[model samples]
Target: MKTTNAYLSKTVNELKPSGIRRFFDLASGMEGVISLGVGEPDFVTPWTVREAAILSLEQGYTSYTANAGLLELRQEIAAYMAREFQVAYQPDSEIIVTVGASQAIDIAFRSILDPGDEVIVVEPCFVSYSPLVSLAGGTPVHVQAETEQEFKISPKKLESAITSKTKAIMICSPNNPTGTMLNKEELQKIAEIAERYDLLVISDEIYAELVYDEVYTSMAAINGMKERTILISGFSKGFAMTGWRLGFVCAPKEITAAMLKVHQYGIMCAPIMAQYAGLEAMRNGQDEVEEMRKSYRRRRNYMVSSLNELGLSCHSPGGAFYVFPSIQTTGLTSDQFAEQLLMEEKVAVVPGSVFGESGEGYIRCSYATSIEQLQEAIKRIRRFLEKQTS
Candidate 1:
């Protein structure tokens, strides 16, 4: 009989498991663990959005949508992008409704990358970026964003990662693990580099609706960037529809057509009910989205303050529900701090090193939980820090 490793693709067999899922798994087995590991919003999907999905099923509309997704939903997404992200797409030609933003990324990479092609993956980023690049038969060249730069990759650092084989650059803003968002000016700088280097930019804006202090600029909206950008977003974060798994991607028509083949073969279409829910969300879920944004803002403030007071150097992220805080003061590695804190205090956090080497001295804690849970976690963290010092 063949060995397990021999049976598997060497590419996948050699890859490590996601660090985020490992902590989430550990937390799941324990009692009374306040887990800040997963980045999902705690709010239920808005009643209106949920009702749309329910009513669709009630009306016997459970069939698969067009491979590109529902026309109505795509039109709504097109309009929403124009209004909110300052980008325009011909929904009929330049957009594809995906299973989720994650799938959009996967299809985009598979559409564009040839074997040995390179994608500049900015770090510390979501755990999936580099892996997805590899899975798509491209090499992932990581360029790190350290804490001193507020976790935003500089255009210089980005350009330095480019090579003749570089076909694309992948970015997430407001980023996961660290919630830093790049404003228009900063994005424009990267856009210039992409134009100069003739690189495609895959921008994941899953946390677009969660931004507090800065405006969320779509990468496609930057001058000369629209043609080179694959804009991916989903209803999961903005409309509290994580379970719905509805996402969309916008790109130039030619690129969209190429990605469509990958999407069609890999995922026939997004769920019809979720597409209906996404339609309702894009059209009428603004108020609920704002409400959630406000709540996350409050939690962001509280978590940042508490972590700093407890002697962990924390950055107040502009968007997203997570904070990357330094655990270096306690003289422990990110893994050590996270593991010890979880075992001793029943608080589960992901070590930042899981994101990349630059994340080694930090840990990622999500503020997607309620304030009460955050407060308790803060107390436990304080106690853990005290023990670390003593």
Candidate 2:
């Protein structure tokens, strides 16, 4: 047998398995678990979007189109971004359709990072950023954003984290776990900082369409940001097409050109059928998106109110489908709370610490589930919390 290599890359050896995976795996074997641990939307892809994929299959558009994806799909993405988000792109030179926002993240990191270069990421953030940055031979510099700040990373926090070696910053608006969105003024501040420091902005806007009250700002839309930001978005959150594996990125011509080469070698294009579905979503899925957004808002309000009534203080999220509630009163660590809730109450939640160190003392409940399920989960949590407190 070959001996395990002692000289494994420090980046590879230091990385930990995703914290969310363990809770999901433990809950998987349980028969009655009511899972709110997943980040995916509970909604299915709209009928029209599904039909479009089927139509593509029927029309024999099953073969791989191009490394950058089909031109028509790119054009539709360009139009959709312009119409909905007020961002502009050349589509042909500045965009590459990806397998999902996950792949877009990977490609962007790979294209930009060199060994020892630092990428600043705000916590509690999506779980993949650090590892992805590491895999690209870069350091992930985490700036902890407090819940007192509504989990929004301030420009001051960012300023303090930047160093001479800082190469880029990863930003996720309508953020996961926290559901905190940076408002226009915040975006302006961030853009100004990036301009001053000459840092590349990798803006993850997958939840752009899901904001409740504040208008979503694409970093690329900010003045001086179009050239300095790599904008990543997908159909997963917005169009309820998670399994479709469709996403895209837009960047300055030079950056996009570099990303396309990496994408070509790593992932030729997003799935052809999914690309077709994504095209239809951009062109005609507006009403479906609006309906889902409205339902998510209702679920958000209901769940936030219920958790607060149960004595768990929840910050009302402006976007995304999660509620991060303080569970410190139960005198349980976040992981302990989540585990007991699953094992005893048959309800699944994710611990906040799964996102980062800043996430301790809290738990994430995805309101992407239906209102009925949301109500039932909260009821279970209330009973469990009462038992624990008593």
Candidate 3:
């Protein structure tokens, strides 16, 4: 009998289970659990996008294409970036279609990191970066963002995180769990720091379409930064095609080539059906994407206001679907707050500690849920907090 690899690779063994999963599992089994835990959009893939996938299957376009992905899809991706984000990429040489933004992150970390290289990751962040960096034989350096700054990282904070072993800085905007973004001036300052440190920037722009304030700024669009930045984005959030597992990364030709080598061997290619769907979404589904963005913006505004009214200090997120609110008023730890809320009020929100140690005093509530669900969740949360105070 195999002894379960008693000497399992340390990196694999060291991986901490995601905190988001535990709440989801509990909410899944419990009756009447209103979950604000997941970060995915609540919308279905638009009919036009779905129909494109079906048409591809009917046309027998099911076989795997080039490892870098279908040329048509890549061209469409390039066009979309140019049209929407003002970023440019040569479809043939500077982009690799991956399984999702998740896979793009994995491929990037593996490609750039040798053992012990350091990557600066801002918290509270999406949960995968730290573990993925470790899996790639790199150390993740976490820099905590303060609530007064709306959880946005400052250039001074970033400068302090860098050292001789630092290889890259990971940027997510509209950031996960926080829904915060780095403005143009902020991006320029970060670009200056990255230029000085000779750091690679792996920017996760998966939520680019969900911005409610001003236009989303692509780090790649900043001069002197484009060549050093690897942009990762996908149809999952913007087009509600999460299940399709389609994502891509755009980078300098040399970096893109290296990433494609890994994709060729490990991933082979993204799902053919999904690539077809993504192409269609980029081409003709603009109106649908806009509609979903409007809805999420409305929900975000409502949720943040409600949480603030309860005397919880919640910042208005400029983008993304989450609202990170301080739960300090209840004097409960993030985990304790989430647990009591779920058990007593039948409402589920993620504990901030799941993102990193800096997330301790807050909870991340996603507004991807429906308006009706959002209203009910706020009611439950209000009751739960009142009971705690009483």
> How many clashes does each candidate structure show, in the order listed?
0, 0, 0
Model with the higher TM-score, candidate 2 or 3: 3
**Model 1 spans with C-alpha error above 4 angstroms:** none
Candidate 2 lDDT, 45-82, residue by residue in tens: 99999999999999998898789999999999999889
Which digits, one per residue and each the tens of the lDDT, describe model 3 over residues 1-390?
A: 657877698679778788999999988989998989988889999999999999999999989989999999999999999988888899999999899999999999999999989999988899999999999999999988766889878788889999999999998988988989888888898899999989999999999899998888999999888899999999899899999999999999999999998898898999899999998999999999999999998998899899999998999999989999999888899999999899999999999999988889999999998999999999999898889878
**All candidates in order of lDDT, best leading:** 3, 2, 1
Full-model lDDT for every candidate: 0.90, 0.91, 0.92
Pairs that collide, model 2? none
> Could you tell me which 10 consecutive residues in candidate 1 have the lowest summed lDDT?
146-155
lDDT for model 3: 0.92
Q: How do the residues 1-390 of candidate 1 rate in per-residue lDDT, one tens digit apiece?
A: 987778899899979999888888888899999988878999999999889989999999989889999998889988898899788899899999998898999999999999999999999989888998999999999999857988988777888889999999998999998999999988998899999988899999999999999777888888889999999899888788888888989999999999999988888999999999889888899999999999999999999998888778888898999999998887888888888999999999999999988889999998899999999999899888888778
Model 3 misplaced regions, further than 4 Å? none
